[model samples]
Target: MNLYKPTDERIWTGREAGQNLYVYQKVEQIDLELQNIPVSGDKTFVLMGYECDEGVRRNKGRTGSKEGPQTARRQLAKLPHHLNENTAIFDAGNVVCVGDDMEKAQSVLAEKVTQILNYKGLPLLLGGGHDIAYGHYNGIKKFVDNDQKIGIVNLDAHFDLRSNEDGNNSGTPFYQIATENSNGSLDFPYLCLGIRNDANDKILFERAREWNVKYIESELFHKQNTSYVINKINEFCKEVDFVYLTIDLDGFSSAFAPGVSAASPMGFSVDIALVALDTIISTNKLISADVAELNPTYDRDDQTAKLVASLLHFIIHKVSLL
Candidate 1:
């Protein structure tokens, strides 16, 4: 398992003798190798943990997200199953960062993600940090042709396009990606949702424009005008063949998602957030997805992890509907 550690604690326990649907033990935890998952069928949700946060530490953000994968697994396992017998789930375990070599960890994650997609399993990546997006994107690139159009839709507060001159930190994945595009390496049709103007600076905005990045401001996600946001997503959906969806917990208001690397004070609400996600998911063009920045250390009573699980639950449920 190169950089991967087998998923061991996906199990859930409760007090007293009781029948429970919220317990993770209710679901099966199989030790899945890349060869075991089905390549074509009803589709299974393959859970892979990207367990490294060196990027966040480099980005000067909170560093506890390295533990995000297992924390999220605890909550996700308890989510009530909404799909039928036709659909199943598998845990491929965590890609542990044995050292501070973040680049190596990301490359390893990209390889694992490629294996999962090759098997026709929908990779539901649990993150170490939002930097997970870089490797996550690379994995999707493996299954896609260079001539094919792939849209990257990031649900986050920051552009994450910060200059990588400082090296590959959590804030610089997209910038490194766009720079990679300078060589005409591959197509990166990117659209960032929930970007807060206050969180980014003039240089970042300038870089975004230079990269031709499409975005919707965080303020627009308010009550009066969320439909336009949906319209923006729908329009972005129309442009590409497949979309790589990344959800950053910080994209939501710190009130709802306080357990992230960098919490946003004016982030979107859970209600509208779900709406935008459903709009994209319903389109059925999702290639793969990841939920990043779930730092359980900062979370209030596990609310953020629960929210991440809810999104996962809803996403799997929606896929089953399709």
Candidate 2:
């Protein structure tokens, strides 16, 4: 689709780092139309950016993730090689949000993601907003068999089950997903971890219960009890065939991850979050994933961006071993 703008402004980097070459110098990127994209049998990743934050604006939160995709690329491209095995990664370009039309942008993302999944490549989206979840799920749905169960796990401060009663916004993606799942034959096994009670209202909690969503609060999954949370997630993963993990940067403490739309002061610590992430990866159930809500304009010394790059490196390295 014309909505996709493919540019290599940051996908290339210097090779002076030797065997520790960054992804930019090694990864293949798509600079052509989505229809002409090729499939690779190796551990292929199709990285797409949802460069729109209209959903964040509609939900009355900070907005700047439109630059998230490129920002992440800039970071990922230059990271030291960490993978244990050879892999193929692609930069599929960004789905731009023009004229404040987020719906169209999401549609384009869905189409692009579907194409990648169809080619047997895992789709790893860079955040524009949590609204990217709605588009991300749609694309996965298009590629999965009708009978395959899809379980979604969100690592965020809020439940994101806010009413679409107002309209489609960042806080309404999971609620919208629930409604869609209810109308279809697939299971709605949604698990949200690291949620902060203060970040969501009573009504949102009620909505989560109504949707039969399962969640683990931040207080219960802090640094002191991450092992417990890992056990919980492993049990949750037992119910589905495919897993999609989305990490909203705001789920981390503002001190650790200040570059988000809604920074949380008492959120998960880096160690706790990393343990949870590593445990999830170890489960070997993850099919696709994305890191959302990285607002570069609000970052402190690029802390959040670097953290994301670190997580991406870890995930890629682990997935390669699997």
Candidate 3:
């Protein structure tokens, strides 16, 4: 818990241009430790950052994603506000990873997430790496009853179901979740979209099949099967009591998301990704979500950061309706 940093008031700032109200003017910094903050019968959202890329480093990928949260905040702050005046949106700050202790960092993140969920506040996590998913899922499990069916929907170019044999890393989060499911925690109903064939190995596919994970390959997205994908997402959403959505930026084409830990040339486009995201939001089953793998070091002119911010803005706007 010592690793948890309370929200910084300085990160939200923007030029007051015209009649537009931006997120910087609306977001409030709140203590995650507080219990039972009054919500006005509306969906409340809390934003937290996981400031650790140790998982990416362990996976031998790009190493600068530790700076992702701050950059994402800066971009998000400048976006025009879309939620109502009374909407309870708070910045809960970051979970810092000191030294190379990734497991401890994840444990701390899980605790923080559980704290937010304790008050029925939905978490919108800004990741330090895809490994954030493991901690995110654990937190949700802690809050939701074991009898409730929680489904995971990941939009990523890779399955991320790699064995954690060497140890847990960004590539092993889903596998960790699968292992937990195998231990009889709950039935794992996972739907992975935007899977690029070249990004994953034969062994990964074998593991996915062995685990009975349902996936929509990147080729399907490229072929413009929007209706089919939407139907699949709806079906997945209908079967779960709660949905945990994780968006890995690398799932988008390198042209749209070149600043990720792993950029794939054959990934899907932004428009389709947006459509899929909107479809998920429409389900009213989404309980928590996160945007992962935004490596600012590899970003071009902050394009990826803007894309990340825009996605968050869209989420906030749509979720406010539900």
Predicted structure with the largest lDDT when compared to the true one: 3
How well does model 2 score by local distance difference test?
0.83
- Worst lDDT run of 10 residues, candidate 2, spans 32-41
Structural similarity to truth (TM-score) of each candidate: 0.93, 0.94, 0.95
- Give lDDT tens digits, candidate 1, residues 23-118: 363344544554466543576778888898899999999999998988888888766665656676777888877778888888888988888888
Least lDDT summed over 10 consecutive residues: which range in candidate 3?
Answer: 32-41
lDDT of each: 0.83, 0.83, 0.88
Alpha-carbon error at 143 in model 1, in Å? Answer: 1.0
lDDT for each residue of candidate 2 in 1-322, tens digit (9 for 90 to 100): 3678885665556456656467775677685374555655558777888888899999999989888877877778777775433577777788888967888888888888788887777878898899999999898888889988888989899889887987899999988888877866323789988888899999888877776788999889777886688888898889888899999999999998999998878988888877877888888888889999999999988888888888887787777777
- 196: Cα error in model 2, Å: 0.8
- Model 1 ranges with Cα > 4 A deviation: 9-35, 183-187
lDDT, residue 115, candidate 3: 86
lDDT of 3 by residue, 214-304 (tens): 8999889753688999999998899899999999999999889999999877888988888888999999888999999999999999999
Better of 1 and 3 by TM-score: 3
Report the candidate with higher TM-score, 2 versus 3: 3
